[model samples]
Target: MTKYRLFTPGPVEIPERVLAAMAKTDVHHRTKEFMQIFSSTAEKFRQLVDSEHSPLFLACTGTGALEAALINSAQEGELCLYVSAGKFGERWGKIARRAGIEGVPIEANWGDSPALSKVRETCAAHPEAKVFCIQHCETSTGVLHPIEEIIPMVREECPSALIIVDSISSITTSSLSQRKLGIDILICAAQKALQLPPGLTILGLSNRAAERIQEGSPHSLYFDLKHELKNQAEGSSSWTPAIAHILGLGEVCQMIEEEGLDHMIERHNRLSKLCRFGLTQLGCTPVAEEYPANSLTPATPPEGIDAEVLRKKLQNTFHVLIAGGQDHWSGKYFRVGHMGSFSEADMRMFLGVLYDALSEMEAKLPEKAEFETSLCSFV
Candidate 1:
């Protein structure tokens, strides 16, 4: 089977070294050897979030982590405030409904940022709200929320409400300090910036947040944060983890350590620009031109051209798979992912193919522009 070079958000193109790490001979989850690997890998997660406590590992996606965090912290029937500017933000409401909590949204249009006054008003009105859920980067619209400004307002207006941020798609691509932000719970997965295959969830909880979780009994045993806190402190999991994925993440940590996490983040930021520029030259307009997330770039093809058709052609014809819009956006826009394991050179390859594909499709383009690789080079 041929592997399509993935320009999709995730599961992105995993580097060969991470793949090799996952292929290493499996170790027994209960053994001393496994304990060493588990302990060290867990610390890497702690460092990733700049947290003092070692993070809990889960055998689930970011959504499952969201469910686990929500179920563990907020009681059933409690009032919770969430941002609904994009699909992932709307998920907080869906998860709340499933858990029987009343979720009120600080709603906005798809590509717009949630207003501070709106968020502040919600917290003031519902001071008793258990949690305020938000996405650090709303993946669907490629919008990065003003969490830095919003978090402090929540802390002041609603002292009791816990701040839960799902950084599923933004973690390594952006710089987020859990302690500095005073976030109760920060959630991300292995699939995105870590450049690994899916099926592992990394969660970090503040001391206050961890204590709050222990005070309440979670609805399910498997999603119980209290149990995870107890077992992970002893360098183990309450259940068998995705051992291979954990190992692969360890490999990613080593890679970042060598590349320097700061440099990796800056590279992603540059890649976002590179992709947006390339797409524009190939005749597409930036869909979320303002406050765009450095993780990906969403661009709309020239008038009357279907974005899904263009995306499919790029994937099937050129073997370069980028992402298309979701829901109302499905046919209107497409996204080119530049997060994790993608260097400037990889992005150049994608641009070359995309340019040819656009020309073949006869896209009505503006004056042609060169990539000017020298300007975008990381070297």
Candidate 2:
């Protein structure tokens, strides 16, 4: 039997209350009862993103939201800038190409965020660019982009550009507000810091973004923001919606509202710091020290130890499952997720198991140093 706890970046473990909420008797999407749930969920979403405007709901993954944001905000002939630093960032570039949109990508090293100065310079040169795409948190490398700094530069340098952000992993955990930041499109999913199961995708759109959609593009159908918004106004969806997922999202939103969004972000921040402190004492280095993600930590495996082997041992022996790196960093680094219904005890359990695994690998720590260091940060 698969008995290991999940610590992967996405599809994190869900709370029992949230799952139970999903198990409630189903209702028709067009029913007034369902609309009440939809409206309540949308309000919570606005609070999550700190937006005053309504957002579109989709029955797909984060990638589908990205596609919607891209196709709806810009057109086939219009130039769009895709900023890439990790695997998820690259996915945006690939989506743009497949949509036949004129896209120019600015790439940074896998473990680092794109340089704000470089992004500004590119935007200044491309005066005709219609949209600038960014990922708020790059899950692949645990790097958080400085969207606040980059967005202002794009606004000043390329006033016509619509800022589209993939906030799939950052929205609820990070310190970003859609209204304060002036983001045109903010995309997120239920499976991240929302502490719910996968299936429901949510997006917040600024009025500016909605106005731009009137110009239209040929690449969208079910993912079209205009269509979704119209259906949403009628208290319905464009098609058959994920009723259970929406119900679960409403329950998750209730939990978030009760906990308060600020407290939730602080909780993730605390867990992230605790995880980092424990990993550092284990002699592992962080991938992005300058701007590490609050939701996950990507740590380089100690020398002479295979990252995948360590991850496997943590799962099979200790029943503690962490994540492995993707793309170029695969087998070189492993990720530990600290988002969604996680606490200090969870962090301690993971670190204790990791400590045991390292000892089994014959990786020596300096006497009681690791434990002492972790206590200082965690306690």
Candidate 3:
């Protein structure tokens, strides 16, 4: 039997050690052992993101954490600026709207990073905007926004606005330091760059963000960060937690510490460079030019080549899974993820398979040359 490999952005392959850790017998959530695991994992999360203040953990998806940040930071009917460049970015707008907040979307074309100037102009126009929400890495288009540049502009222009970032894919893949970046709320999930399975979400809240929650908002229940913090202070979750996932997360944290956070990010950078180089040599153009995502790369399909068909062939024939584009780009582009539980060898194999699939579809590609170029680029 052949083993299947996952190359999608979320639900990336889990490390064997992490899987083994999850296989352990379930422990009582109230026990000291569980709390120890929780505390240790929280510390590692802070170290990984280089946050001075620790983040809170929730047994939820990345979207749940995002909602938590939105609900806690801003009040109903308040102006919220959403910098939307892709699907996930648009989701932020949708979430804000659902929460009864007035969401003003700053639109950017898909495959394009959000412009700092545009964000600044929006803030200046809507001085009443209480929360500025943006995705650090837009997974759909594989575009990395200029958060570092935009953050300062927001800080200078709208000092009262809290910066909420969805760093789900960029947490470990890119060089991100939440505190240093001046982000008030940073939301991430274990299923992305953390190399763990879904079921755990983390929110690194700045003191300013906590104070905003205390000031009051209509957002309540299930995702209230303030309530979660109170429960976490006593070493517990407000709701029943996923014990096995927490155990797996503990092991993942150990692996991350052992590898060193900076080194891990550097590794991801190297792998992303290789993937981009290989894709370019294959005559496939990347979606984003200015700031391509470090975790995943979305490649536009060659003329007359159906990306969805190619993606299906890659999975069915080669036992490799790749993600298809979402929303408007659906079937037009496909994504190759190089984050979490993936190594240089895995990337080489994936690229080779992609080359073979494209060649079979009559898309002339410089397979051997591109592979060599990718290797040289990585080195």
Which one is best on lDDT?
Answer: 1
Per residue, candidate 2 scores C-alpha lDDT tens digits across 246-294 of: 8888888888888888998999999888888888888888778998899
Candidate 3 residue lDDT tens string, 1-379? 6677889998888888888998888588898888887777778777777665667888888888888888788888888888888888888888888988899998999988757778889888887789999999998888899888988988877888999999999987888888899988888888888888888988887878777876764557787766777777676888887778878877887887788888988989888888887787778888787898889999986677899999998888989989998877888899998898678888888878888898888997665775667556656
Sequence-dependent TM-score of model 3: 0.95
Write out the backbone clash pairs for model 2.
Answer: none
Of 2 and 3, the candidate ranking higher by TM-score: 2
Judge candidate 1 at residue 175 and give its lDDT. Answer: 84
Lowest lDDT block of 10, candidate 3: 370-379
Candidates' RMSD to native? 2.0, 1.5, 1.8
Error of 3 at 157 (Å): 1.2
Candidate 2 runs further than 4 Å off: 368-379
Q: For model 1, how does the per-residue alpha-carbon lDDT over 1-379 read when each residue is reduced to its tens digit?
A: 7568888888788888899989978578888888889989999878878875778899998899999988888898888899999889999999999988889999989988878899898888988888989999898989989899999999988788889999988998988999998888999898888898889998888888888888877678899889888988887899888899989989998998899889988999988887877776666788667678989888888767889988888878888888999999999988888898787888888877876777777877543344444334424
